[model samples]
Target: MYKLKTKETDNSVIEFIEQVEQPKKREDAYRLLDIFAETTGFEAAMWGPSIIGFGKYHYKYDSGHEGDAPLVGFSPRKAKISLYFATGDTEREHLLEKFGKHTTGKSCVYINKVADIDEEVLKELIKQSVLFLQERYPGK
Candidate 1:
């Protein structure tokens, strides 16, 4: 059986942010912390060593893989900040069109800094991701 590695832990989100080598990235992490918390109405928690996540949802795939994940999250990384949001929402793609300087992966958005993107669009993305995940994984 495959086990999830990124389980939630009792780690300190603030302490994790403080360890970010880039002072600017550390500051942006704080800013993103506030925005995601306020927008999603979920408390930030540590996911693995790097990801600061909010809320919780349980997901079981067709292959019988199951685990819990955060509704939304972000990691202040060395190359760029990674924003984690639920996939499958077309609105997420639409909002990313106006999200400014950012790149996308399967479910992560990479940004150089917070100032490089529109904060309002970030908020919208957060809102949409939370809604999409909640609907997809109801009761979570």
Candidate 2:
């Protein structure tokens, strides 16, 4: 059986943010924490070591790979701030069109800083991600 590496931990989100070497990144992380918490109406929790996540849902793929993951999250990495969102949400793509400066991975958006992106769009992405995941995973 395969186990997920990025499981949620009891680590303090504030402690993690404070450790970010870049002052701007650390400040942006705190801002993101506040924005995500306010937008999702859920308490922030540490997902793995770096990601500050809000809410969670369990997922089982057709291949039987199953795990619980944060509905929305972000990590202020050395290179960029990575924002996690539902992979196939069309609304996410639409919102990103107006989301200021950012890059995208399959399920993550990378931004240099919080000021590089539109905060309203970020909130919408977070909202859509939670809704999409909840609908996809249902009661889980």
Q: What TM-score does each of the candidates earn? A: 0.98, 0.97
Whole-model Cα lDDT of every candidate shown, in order: 0.95, 0.92
- What does candidate 2's lDDT look like per residue over 27-140, in tens digits? 999999999999999999998888898999999999999999999999999999999999987898899999999999877899999888889989898899899999999985
Superposed Cα deviation of residue 96, candidate 1 (Å): 0.4
The candidate maximizing TM-score is: 1
Model 2, global lDDT: 0.92
Identify the candidate with maximal lDDT.
1
- What is the per-residue lDDT of model 1 for residues 25-130, given as tens digits with 9 covering 90 to 100? 9999999999999998889999999999999999989999999999999999999999999898999999999999999998799999999999999999999999
Give the 10-residue window scoring lowest on summed lDDT in candidate 1. Answer: 131-140
**What overall lDDT, based on C-alpha atoms, would model 1 receive against the true structure?**
0.95
**Cα deviation in Å at residue 135, candidate 2?**
0.8
Task: Rate residue 101 of model 1 by lDDT.
Answer: 98
